[model samples]
Target: MSGFVVMGITAFAASAYVTLDMSQARPEVHGPAHYGLLVAHIFTGTVAVVAGVSQFWPGLRSRHPRVHRVMGRVYFAAVLPSALLGIVCAQLSFYGLATSGPLTVLSVLWFASAAQGLRTARRRRFGAHRIWMIRGFALTSAAVTGRLWGLLLGGLLPDADGLLVFTTANWLSFVVNLLVAEWWIQSRGYTRALPSEALKPSISSRSAQSSASVA
Candidate 1:
């Protein structure tokens, strides 16, 4: 997990360098509006990636509750705006809807997962909250995984169509990530408490009932 976080940060750093430095001579964006949204997307996305990873560090939450809570807030705060801007920027993608469509779908899922995580946390459903947040982080990690996929595929099939590879990676990145998250949840035995179970009598209450029945 730590290795993954480090890889994510490294990828983000490389991308940020190319994005923010004018000397990099990056390809042109559509116009000022598109450029602005893209910039906002990058900034908020960076924040989300940085803060989101810390929330899952093995001992961070239990060892430092205050830091965990603060970073958790920062993660959700950044992710919402990042996802929103990502959708607009996706529509303006130079790669066309082929790439943009998948990206937009990713952003929508990212937003929903983060929102649900926040909602569950507020309702004091910590188990559900952790699961949803894991989903959210998986979606967010697509920024790294998508680039990794692109690089790996592009290298393996140098003659392949660029658009095809890009589109496939965009879809696979988040889809695979979410699938892995579900697997992890199940493997770890993370179960959501049912509404009925929440209302079930406590063990002590059951014991008391047993005594009274015996009497």
Candidate 2:
């Protein structure tokens, strides 16, 4: 479980590094508005990678639910803003996919999954909340896999065909990533650190208690 989490985060960090640096170096990669999207994407992506890495340090969060909550809040803060920017950039992407299409569709879906997961967990819907979080995490992994496909396609195809192939490959990567992660969850036994309902109170209580003791 921990390994998977690290792998997922590393992937995102690497992918974002690739995309962000490319966006900076080559004006051709993005349009005027794309520059703004790039900034948001890079900034939020860096936050997520740091937060995700912190999750693995057992003493950092495993022993301290308050710390976990703080980190989770940062993660959500990063994601929500980046997601909105992604919706705009998705419309401007090479595929001509509308903001209402799969590209933007994924952005909305990602936000919804995260929001619903948090909401249900608040309501003590443990299983459903877990499912939604896993789904959201899966969606996030697309950031990584999309870069992998682009790299792979770049090597295989000529420059003229490479960009087209990469775009198509990115679409396939997300579909495949979601399918594989879902399959693993259904067929293989994997569980997160805390149950969703238990997650909220545990963190909030810890935070309150810590603050009270300090006062």
Candidate 3:
């Protein structure tokens, strides 16, 4: 329920921003090229958010593996392009280094995590794949967290400078989400459960049974 609400709000917000004219964009993204990149970022980023959320649902994966796989593909497809466009946009940010620096780092991490997830999945190391995907999705959620933080800070400190608010929000957005993802992965035992180790016991059990029958 909460996830749905967050996704709905994020989709609406991104759509709204994408529809805005170049002149209405932030000073750093006011030009036509930057505006177009922003639109692509928003569209693909929204697809990532939606696809990522579905990928995490255990019911969907357990009951409908095909759907899960499709969603996984969609998630990666959306994340890669979105992260690339985001890096370019961050580089062109008018908000100066303070704001762009963290976002630039975030874009790199986002792409790397998503790529790692894809790699792990292809290797059939599902536990590792889940961990990496969770990390990627956490970073992707920055768009929503950034806005929430901005709203809170803006209301609390109406006189604060815009750049300061943006900088603080940008840092907290991905950092907090990634930290929480790490914690969740640990709590779920995904980090501890390697595919080889999980198969070892079963293989050893089968060998023991075979030896006993021979005896």
Candidate 4:
């Protein structure tokens, strides 16, 4: 987990380094609005990546539950704008529909995962929340994996069609990440908690409140 955190943060740093350069903004592609969207996407996506990883840290979650909750909210908030902007950016990409198609799908799924994660968490379905959040972060990690895929594909098939490479990379990015997430969830026993187990936290909190009221 620690290693994963380091890798996530490193990926964010690399993304920022590469994308945050104003000089690299291709206004000619889709004009100034696209540039703004890219900036917003990268910044909010960074927030999601960082907060998402923090939510998974055992020490942080155990010792600092309040902090965990706060960061979870942060992650949720960041994911919305980031994913929405990603979709817009994809549609407007000069790369045309071939490359944009998979990316648009990825952004939509990313948004849905974040929404589902928050819904489960709100219902006090902690185990389901964990699973959904894992899925959410898996999609978020596509920002990293997508780049890696592009690099690998580019290197392996230097003469490959650019459109094919971009499309393949975009699809593999979230597909592979989600597959790994599913495997980890099952192996780690993160399936939905039993009904009783799911209710324990809420019941305990209510009992504490009752005791305080009586006293």
Candidate 5:
């Protein structure tokens, strides 16, 4: 429910931004070409985020594998193009390399993670695919998390320079999310499972079954 709320709010905000006229867009993106890429990135990115969140829902994947596969396709299709456009938009950012550098790196990471997810899925390595997709989703969610960090920073340091706060928040958003995701995967024992082992019953379960047979 909380995830839905966050995704909804972020989607609403992104959709609103994309709909804004050139005159209403940021000064740096007033040019038609730049604005178009920005809009494209936002729209496709919003789709990716929404789709990615649904992909993580265990019930949906476990009960409706077809839906999961479809959603995964949508996520990859949307995210790959979105990340590419994002790289271009980042390069054109008014904040220059300070902001663009980190954003560009993030875009690259986003594309790589999504591509890795696709590769793993194609190889039928569902466990590795899930982890990579989670990484990709965390990067995608940077759009929301970055703004959140900005808001928190704004509230805490009302007098801080806006650009400085934004740059800091931007870096923290994806970096922190990725770190937390890695920690979650480790804590869940996901990293210890082999690609083939993932879909099989656990050793403990087999042991229990054997003991039951003996009884």
Candidate 6:
């Protein structure tokens, strides 16, 4: 459900940026990083969307573990360069147009959580992996949300005042995005969730019988 919203938002964000930064005869901002950020965000977000949607398809996953794993690696690889580009681009954000410092912080945190989540998951800590990955993904959605809010508010404000409103509204996306994640984890009662090891099947002789039935 959340992934659907994320995919739509990210695709919109990418398209919006392409219009704003790339397609314009005269761009609003001509910074080199602006173009780079747009490219990174679009490519990586698209990859994430595809891979993420696959997670919901258990039949596909069951039949194609290799495909699933390959996409997982692609997501991880995409995050790294995208995250680095985000950090670089944050500094060039419009001042009074937005708060660069906080955006930079959010980008850094997003990168760390995502990179660490992938690494930990590879090491077999599935529960921790989900936690960190979810945290990272929540931040990923913020990019999309930020642009949406900025556009919405831009329409309400006068041309002269639109930039400020857009900037302020954009940063709120991160706050709102994280708040949604925290609320979801709490609402699902996963805050006190136990270790993955606790869910392992017991080693009784009857375990073979259970496994046979499942197979």
Q: Estimate each model's TM-score.
A: 0.83, 0.66, 0.87, 0.81, 0.87, 0.72
Segments of candidate 3 deviating more than 4 angstroms = 18-20, 195-215
Lowest summed lDDT window (length 10), candidate 5:
18-27
Q: What lDDT would each prediction earn against the true structure? A: 0.83, 0.64, 0.88, 0.84, 0.87, 0.69
Candidate 2 lDDT over 31-105, as tens digits, reads 545766666665675565456445446687558978976876776777777778767766666546522265677
- For all candidates, the clash counts are 0, 0, 0, 0, 0, 0
Clash total of candidate 1: 0
Better of 1 and 3 by lDDT: 3
Ranking by lDDT: 3, 5, 4, 1, 6, 2
Q: Which regions of candidate 5 are displaced past 4 Å?
A: 18-20, 195-215
User: Where in model 6 is the C-alpha error above 4 Å?
Assistant: 16-27, 31-34, 56-65, 94-97, 155-160, 196-215
Q: Is candidate 1 or candidate 2 better by TM-score?
A: 1
> Which pairs of residues collide in model 4?
none
Per-residue CA lDDT of model 4 for 89-181, tens digit only, reads 888877688877888999999999999999999998888888999999999888778878988999999999987987899899999999999
Per-residue lDDT of model 1, residues 1-215, tens digit only: 66466456645554744555544423348766666677778778888888888888869988999999999999999999999998887888887889789999999999999999999988988888989988998998888888788899999999999889989988989999999999998888786442557688999999999999999
Candidate 3 yields a Cα-based lDDT of: 0.88
Question: In candidate 4, how many Å is residue 50 off?
Answer: 0.8
Per-residue CA lDDT of model 5 for 135-168, tens digit only, reads 8888988988888898899999999998898889
Q: What is the lDDT of candidate 5?
A: 0.87
Give residue 65's error in model 1 in angstroms: 0.4
Q: Per-residue lDDT for 1-215 in model 6, tens only?
A: 66677777766555655554465422244565577565665577667655655654677668988887787777777777777776766676656325666667777877897789788877987667767766777776676677778777777765747656755775687778788877887787665674665577568746897889999
Kindly give the stretch of ten consecutive residues in candidate 1 with the minimal lDDT sum: 19-28
